[model samples]
Target chain A: MNDKITTPQTIVLIITTLIGVWITTLPATLAEKSGPDSWLMVIIGGGISVLGAAIVTSTGRQFPEKTFIEYSVETLGVFGHLFNLGLIIYLVILTGMVVRIFGEVIKVFLLDRTPIEVIILTMLALCVYLTRHGIEPIARTAEVLLPILMLPVIIIYLMIILFNGDLSNFMPFLRLDFKEIIAGTKATVVSFLGFEVLLLFIPLMQNPHQSTYSSFVAILMVSILYLFVVVTVIAVLGIVETSLLIWPGISVLRMTETAGTVFPRMDVVILSLWSIAGFTTISPMLFASAFGISRILKAREFKSFIVPLVPVAYMIAMFPKDVLEARKAVEAVSNMGLFYIFVVPLLILTAHWIRRRVLNR
Target chain B: MKGKVFILTVLIGASIFFHGCWNMMDLEKKTFIMMMGIDALPEGQQDKIKVTLTMPVPRQLVGAEGGGGPRPETPQQILQSTGNTVYGTIRQITNRLSRQLYFEHMTAIVIGEEAAKGGLDRFLDVFQRNKDFLRMAKLYICEGKAEDVLKMETEMEPLVVTYINQIVHFNSSRSLRAINYSIGKVITELHETNGNSLVMRIRPEKKEAVVAGSAVIKNWKLVGWLSDRETRGILWMLKEINRISVETSIELQTPQKGLVVLDLVNFTNKTKAKIQDGMPVFYINMRGEARIVEKEERIIKKEENLERYEKPIEQAITKEINNALQKVQDEYRVDVVNFGEHLRKYHPDYWETVKEKWDLMFPHVKVVLNVDVKIRRQGIFK
Candidate 1:
């Protein structure tokens, strides 16, 4: 928390955070709803999330060095305290949902028989360790690991295309009706939920005014990456097959073979890399929650909130009994996140505007 | 610093105690199932599927030139068990085999005609559900028991799985003798299409296995078979023909008017569906480039003769494709050539109305085939 993050670090953090478990599951969900037009839905969804990120970053920019909790209180007076509490609750729940999903995906792909608690705990422990150092260390960590995480993913997608991808899977483009297209876009928008973490981290940026630009650039990069992944999965596995898979991204990588390499399977390498990406996502969420709590209580030290919040996050993550339940819980959290992204930011901005007018008058 | 070290030590200790290492097995102790075979259970047996696993011996894969007493006999072991489900059957076999059975390297799965006839939907459930099994494994339908194909002793390669993989992958590029259908493709065809598709048919000879033709599966049940020539025509329509030679004879007013061979260099097919006279009409355009490989009747090595060669080649392809289309559309009554897929994609509104009766309408749909062949080059001297 002592050091300040630059706009590039913010952009890197936004990109990595935006692509968590969604990288594995979004294509299938989109395929289920939009058919081959899932690629179109990705574009629409990314555009919607870019607007969401703009709203979030702009709200943060209004409050100089203050995060969401402090800014909301200054804008709305006593009611802003309730708003801050709601955001804190939202971040904690979002963190818990992410932990559950990250653990569930790793369990399904890599460790079949591992206890779900251990998986969640291992990830939570890393998040706790990272968040204790605050936003600066997290941003720096993201800056260093972004390429390491993204290179393999890009290579995996490129390999699928070069090997034997059939573009016909993406054919019959724009075939979905208006209703289905909107529904598909909604599913894709859920994957872009993690980008809203910008609202909390923007305060830590060295140049807060540049946060909005960095957020848009980060979201655009993530959107293009997601577009490639969704199109690649559809092209390689076809629409119906992609829909049938629980994790089409991992399944698509499993379909490809790198002949000379001794690594028997590429999916293992991808899973390992994806688990690291999941670390970036979960750590930011934990930081947001702990940061929100520290800001509201006016505590000078935020590290104390990290440990006590672990048990709470661990409890919330273990709330879901199975993967299906975990997904439903994550969907609920994502819907709440959507509200915070669109409604909360706009609400705070409007409040600030009204207060400024009254004070000027 | 003291508290940080204490916490770090405790975290490492807890990780060692609670990590996911229980399911770990050494590479030496585990056995990889290179290929699997599913067959119908014996009469009076309660089980539904008899699973056959082909496992390669690591000791035999090592070069046998030096430090080898006699080249290791039986480079692979074929194990079988009967159970109601594929996973259940594998678990049953695991009890009989000393080593743990793993399927990460499984490259192919051969389904017996009997088992395929029983309905492939049920047999494919485990392949789709299991995370360990790869969806990229090539699928083959055997005329007899799949176990026979998996258990065959190969003359060239030591392992039957490698031998089968070579036949499927190599022949797919060289000729249209075998159709390459993976589990992913089959699943997509079954789920997305009208559940009518073709799987490469494999038959075992005494010392070798012949992979050719295709087994037609409709509604996930074995419907019939397509010959090698028929498969070539189907491949041509599907635009999957990699390299194939077509030989056809022409009647000319000459003493030695005879056959001409053309090696297909490139291929492309376009199928469009439209309403003609209030019925679905499929217009298929098949364009190909070929080189004159062999010719019996030698006209002067002129350009007109090469142009004249194209007409006879197109006619020959059209005739073969017509026969194949007739058998698949009229005789077998299956839309395995992706005609329904075209209708569903292009004419969605019409597809909605007739999709239910597609099985009835498929045989009656007027499919017009237009073949265009260009002789790109005529060898060194024509």
Candidate 2:
């Protein structure tokens, strides 16, 4: 846990974690809720999340060598410890929900006959092993896998735009009211939820002060990627078609065909890359939860908590029976994550400001 | 601790091979469906729909390409069954087959006139819900039984489905006579409350099949059809033209005895929809460049002759567009060219009120067609 990561590795972590299962489903969900103005919603929602990431990063910079768990206690005393325990529970539940979603997605696309429990257990076990290696290994793994995961996505999107995209779907722009745009932005906000992992990792960066700028850069990258995906799906599938499709991102990729290629199925390539993204997401969350478990128990080493936390995550992930229920569970976890990422940090920063200024005066 | 780590490594390594082949199905054990067709059943039949599946016999396909001593009797197999639902009939047909049925390679789905007219809502449900069906597969509406078209042998291509798929693909780029609609787009059309789309029409002849024209599907039912020329008009309005030749005869006052033909070179259009007098009005602006591919008797290479040639070609395009628009507005009364979508995108408030009664109001909507043609090239002798 003591090994430090550079600013670039932190950015890669933020990008990969945010790009998980949401890439396949966000376009359809946004299209259904926001019409053709879904890309606008993405920019607005991403702007709001950038403010949150900046706040969380600045707060981490204030306490140089300590993570969120240690600094919260230092600032708020007993209530801070209570908040730390709540964050730990939230992280565990978030890991569970993410694993459940990964399992369900694999079931739908690749291994349909296998039991979902086996899939969830296998993924959780791998994540557990990664978490046991501590934060440095996770960050390095993300660094190595980010390019491999993103190249295919970029190539597929470029091929689609160059060959098959119909830009007429973006017609009648700005027809949506402010209220509908706000509601659609709420869906985009959920996709950006995974960036909150920065809270736990800020202290582990080689230059913690640079995290504020690097985190914003990471969030901007995610926003651009999401905007590209959403706009591409809309342009390729049209608004009505995108809304009707359950997985418009994958559908658009599948619609693309390279001339005279032996391997024609772009969806298969997308799924493989998506698997890497999902793995990055699950491993980081698992590591975050393990860190939280160690902090709650006042233990020195988080490595001890990684193995025991796997069963807990596996049990909670298996709670959702079907895909619909799994989604509902994820929505609940996302709402909880929103509080930890925004309100808790904002309250801590406000308290830190008051303690330094008003009380000293 | 070292023993524990070694044991963990061994367990992890062993688990990969344990489940490596749990759900793997070899290529040989599955019959790859290349084409599918659905037809309506007879009056007294227990089932409401008849489903047909086409697949190539692996051994015969290999032998034919190898140019072996003798070709097999049948290179393809057609299986049929009847059930109340597509899924049920599919299950019934699969019951007799030894290998499992796979549909990932299916290139086309043909629907009979009866099934299409009866409504394609149910037939599309199976493809929508099933993960095996590729939404990119081409859809066709046959004049009679869809199974007949699937069973017809073609000399051009080894498989009838491959031949049909290639024709639809190539024809779509070269001319407006044949149009192909993917299952995904068709399913998307079904989602729209008043959206309309077209399906290619295929008619099986004696040892041959003709693919031309288009069948119009509006509100998930077949309202009518458009001939090859009328289909061209639809394509012109939709701006889907790639490289189509338009032949028009001009009566030159210069005493030319024979008719002249002009081939359209670069065709493009821009349509605008707006609210005027509490009704939707569309202004279609079309621009095309043409060449005098054939001339009967005139050898006038002067600029005046080219100017005179442009008006008759514009009139020819206008006449075709008007005829196509008239049939859609007066006879069938559907906005297959996406006029409603244009209004919905441009004028949302007006679209909300008219969207409910769009079916009734579509026939009365005013459309003004303005076509301008420029003679770009003349023959070398001219």
Q: Pick the candidate with the highest DockQ.
A: 1
What would the DockQ be for model 1?
Answer: 0.47
Once superposed on the true structure, which residue ranges of model 1 sit more than 4 Å away at CA? A257-264, A359-361, B1-24, B61-72, B241-256, B296-304
**Model 1 lDDT at residue A360:** 62
Displacement of residue A293 (Cα, Å) in model 1 is 0.5
TM-score of chain B of each: 0.87, 0.87
> Worst 10-residue stretch by lDDT in candidate 1 chain A?
A255-264
lDDT of each: 0.82, 0.80
Best by TM-score: 2
Report the Cα lDDT for residue A25, model 2.
Answer: 80
Worst 10 residues of 2 chain A by lDDT: A254-263
Highest lDDT scorer: 1
Instruction: Provide backbone clash counts, one per model.
Output: 0, 0
All candidates: TM-score: 0.92, 0.93
- The per-residue C-alpha lDDT of model 2 at residue B17 equals 63
